[model samples]
Target: MNQTAVKRLYLMQVGSMPEYQIPIVCYLVQTDDNRNILIDTGLPEFIPEEASDFVNGQDVVEQLASIGLKPDDIHMVVSTHYDIDHSGRHAAFTKAEYVVQRLHHLDAESNPRFVANRPQWDQPMDRIRLVHGDTELLPGLELIETSGHVPGHQSVLVRLPKTGATLLPIDAVPFGEDFSRNGQDDGKNPDAEAIRASTVKLLELTEREQIGLVIFGHDRAQWEGLKKLPEYFD
Candidate 1:
């Protein structure tokens, strides 16, 4: 019997940026077995200028196609939360399975907090798979529940033999520095207590699991310094 080895996972930057701001971060995680798992769908190409100020309106389909894959090729999509900029074009992958926290889906459906951003998330209700707490979606990838940014935010854990371990802690911690400080000092962010707890938990998990890399939701400075896709462990 042939074993399923997780060869590599790639991150495609499908967003734009300005001179000083950080480019939004959305990624496609391609496994060795040809499973295309997309992390987040960036803001749509056509958004209002006021809203676009906070979004990166790039061509996700074209970006994926650049690497020889199509939006339809995506097998799974893991959304950390239903923020406008993060979960905008989820409909692009019409046939892909979705992984999301249970609370996130519920909040996106009927919560007043998401009233302003309902259009971005409310449309993709049909393709979702809701779960509570943590989950291992596949052989080497695990979803860690770290809800702070929103009611049901979560991150992904990718364990590979060569790359060691990687924590894709979506918006829970926008950058590595967020983990270092308690939320009391982090300023206008999520709930302070939740943020602090999530940060500490992620740090503990990384140390316990021997994780070597961390990918944040919107940290361009960090993403720019990492290895790109199509380069996997042999």
Candidate 2:
């Protein structure tokens, strides 16, 4: 794989919402060397019906196959955050090494504000790898530490050889417009300051990195414009 040649990456929105009809996204970052790296598995049906309602319906495994991938085919699983909707049924990627920021995980479980409000993802401790700081998953893909929404929350930064750079902001700012209107304050969570700081960090990153794309956790419009799996980077 030539570093000089542009690499194409893709996003797969597996689950769906009845309200919006938008699929819940699970990313697939293909490197120059043909490595398949998955990010954030979707929710499974095993969870309570009410809890599962926020997620998209299609099985994440089947969704991957629609794009020519099986669960075992994934090399690494990058979790942006531990929200029930985002974490989904991670057990599917039994063979992939899970990656997440250490601080984000600790804060999510320990912080009174988070524990009291969004306590869904506080899973059993044995789930996956608890990473720290920053990690480079592949040649051009790196996990940047941006923890605002939850303690262990992080986002992905992919630098394709040809496309320059793209930042998968995750839930740092729920939507691209969050930063624009100071909507970082959720009114419910007390971590508003932390969330705002994380958003600023992302803004700084994209400006400095010359990022061509910015992906969010639930940005339906953005995902709709992106190339999906199996047909990525054509």
> Which numbered prediction scores highest in lDDT against the true structure?
1
The number of clashing residue pairs in model 1 is 0
Give candidates' CA RMSD values in order: 2.5, 3.9
| Candidate 2 vs. true structure, TM-score | 0.82
Off by over 4 Å in 2: 1-6, 19-23, 50-52, 107-127, 181-183
Tens digits of per-residue lDDT for model 2, 57-132: 6766887788778888887778887666677657667777777788866766666543322433454556557878
Tens digits of per-residue lDDT for model 1 on 1-234?
665556567765656556546666667766767888888787766765546566454467777777798878999888878776677677778879888889778877787665655665555556778889988887788888887778788888887767778788888887766766454355666477787788888989988987778877667777777665544422
RMSD of 2: 3.9
Any runs in candidate 1 off by more than 4 Å, and if so which? 1-5, 16-20, 55-57, 112-120, 123-126, 181-184, 229-234
